[model samples]
Target: MDLALTAAGASVRAAAALSPRWGAAVALPLFGHVAPPRPVRVDDEPTMWRARRGRLRIPGIDRRGTEVETYEWGSGGRTVVLAHGWDARASQFAPLVRELVAEGHRVVAFDAPAHGASVGRRTYLVDWLDIFSALQERFGSFEAVVGHSFGGLAALVGVAGGIGAQRVVTVAAPADADALLTQFQAGLGYSDAVSVRMRELFASRYFPGERDPFAWLSSVRRPIPAAVPLLIVHDRGDRLVPFAEAERIAAAHPGARILETSGLGHNRILAADVVLDAVLEHIAAPIAAPAAESSAQVADREVVAAA
Candidate 1:
């Protein structure tokens, strides 16, 4: 009887440990982290036909050795590279592209790997950085970079790594990879241990032999690169990415500007008037002349004064 009681207790403990709630908590975040199926629409052909730009094929950054498709609009001179977000196609930036071109700026846009016409099964951070590098080599340095959502994160990483750009604008960008990953995990009910493990797995698989990518955000302190100026924009009502993430990015980068507006959530913020105006303002600002790395200091002072 004693042996049977002991066996029963052990079984109960095991069952409790494997409860549905626990499983859901761990598995949910992992599952949520997986990219969702891109919606298929019938208008792809029509959209392509209407596109005023031509497509260019370039070798992908990943070892997959696939050719990625990049599209471009407008003629040369003071080029602006517009990078779209996760699960988004380059066509999504069409409105902005038209406006920029009308304002006498050339626009270059690309379909990031695994998105739109780009060739890939999946894409990671390195893929983004690689694409940016390729663009810099092929299309020349950009006067400004405008990115939406995940593209915004990629822009930050690219600019920090010295992709020559005078100004950068991110729309609804998450502050950093960790915070974004945490939110993704929480959405799926993942336990802290599982979340950490998954992050490690991602880091190992996506960035082997490389240091933590999130750390790159903090390394922009002094001796700030003269080529990169950052403008961060977020919607206060964004449910996909919290506004705090923008604030965090602003706090980390010396002269980073944060613009918070109401009504435009994650998706719609791209088209919001306030966001468009702010982007134009940032881009039209005079290019910083070569100085003793004091622009960051001056920008910080201006931000503080405005606040």
Candidate 2:
């Protein structure tokens, strides 16, 4: 979140936090920075689930030394990055994080720039990509990258930028960035002029290259780097992001698979047993190996071939 942008946004955000009525203004200039991340909520896990928690400071990105909050679990070679949705903290993934660790994966999750225990009180959807890029630089290649909602969209941005990843998973991700903007406008009851100016401002802040973020939302036409196994998960009952969005993502990526669950709404999908099982199996599934043969079997096979 860039506090240097506008005072109206900051003041409105502060007011919005106190009263939900002001939340309609979230779309104006400070859409992403409208709210601070909710405080860390610890889950009731076994004592063994202790995480190596800390902050990562990048000199260039955060001039004020705003090291972002980060948490890690497991020490296995296979690393999986977990990205939670908009306005949510990294610890929200505690349930999934434990499961991933138990499945023998080194898991890393973080609160985005201004969220969670990180510095600052503002954030933007575009900054999510930057966070992933910074983490990828420090962590190297990931075995799998998992994202939900807005975070899922950021995962797409990372993939487009060639962040090293073996597999990608998105849960209830938006199909188009333009759609997000429209939703924001409608949510705030803002006019077309506001939407247009906001787009210009957003472009300047994040996509200065004149690149289209909406296109990037579904950017798998060429399958970003030719190919990367993708899993798109969504629930038909989700009210926040529709199930059709997942279908569109699947359609964009030729081989991308879509898994639709039931009754898990938008947020509850993270806790559903079926969703957890699917994600675990996808990332933890091993490559097939040739069957080992005993000397007697080898001899028998050789004899049979000779005969």
Candidate 3:
């Protein structure tokens, strides 16, 4: 993985050095890399197998062409929805889902378009928004929504766009489109000129009326209702997303509370006990405690046996 990323970085730098215009052309696919389907086969958690699964067709430019896979872990109760980051599938939430289920709240998580088992090769911000919209219609307003990285940004955008989740949690997520572009460039070693053109291409291609890609992401800064609470959590040591992004997000939404972690890093934040406990406290949609705990333990043993 390191070698491949290094090669990609070298290629972008070389292309940018030759011609700024052609450099942007080369970077176009990198932007598209954001939406590409990824291969993921990690299935260590047992909770994944115990859940009920369903699929919903996404309404895209081509009606009924895209579909997303959904997983339901518990029955009727205040629900907490989960959204995974780019290149991640829904099952990545197994640990957090089990905790939520143990606490007695229903948990629903879905594979975003082009990720996991969902159909299609491309996904975008709209795909995230639309999936949350569909889930909201079916589950009504969620007790809370937990999203990591790109997924975190989506939840905030969804809230702004009227997909209701009473409580919000964003972990290691970027604050704006510009922040994302800057990080991508820094990692891939793309020139500032190339990043600018890539943004232009993105704006022209997906957002016709908008000239800047950041405009589409402006919803992250839109005013959220005072009634809804948001929590912004990030690890200072994370290499993928800077902690400053979380600060900016918290600053943008005055109602948001900020939490910082130490060595857990980006993806590891999802697995930390402290993070799970913090999330449970914010949502406070507990199930019948002792019974729920026993059932959750049984489910875990079943999962291990099945594995």
Summing lDDT over every window of 10 consecutive residues in candidate 1, give the lowest-scoring window.
298-307
The local distance difference test score of each candidate is 0.66, 0.68, 0.75
1 or 3, which is superior by TM-score?
A: 3
Q: List ranges where model 2 is wrong by over 4 Å.
A: 1-28, 41-49, 58-65, 209-213, 217-223, 286-307
TM-score, every prediction = 0.77, 0.77, 0.83
lDDT digits (tens) for residues 2-112 of candidate 1: 463344334433433566344434442232232443553453444444455544444454464665667666677688998888778777776676678778887888777
Clashes of each: 0, 2, 2
lDDT of 2 by residue, 1-307 (tens): 2444455445544545554344333444456553766765545244124878867665323234456778888886788999988777777777788798787889998877767767776666556666677778778888988999988877876786778888888888876677677766554544465556667666655556777654565544423443566778888877888777776666666545677777777887887777787788778665334444332321100000100
Best by lDDT: 3
Cα RMSD of all models vs. native, in order, equals: 8.4, 11.8, 9.0
**Model 3 misplacement above 4 A:** 14-18, 34-44, 60-64, 211-213, 285-307
Query: Clashes in model 1: which pairs?
Result: none
Q: Which ten residues in a row have the lowest lDDT in candidate 2?
A: 298-307
Residue lDDT tens for model 3, 1-307: 5786788888878888988777777766665454445544365357777889998777742345687899998877588999998888887788898899998889999888778878766667778888888888898988888999999988887887688777888888888777777777777887778887777877776566775547548534564554567777788888888877876776666545677788788887887887877788878833322221221121000000100
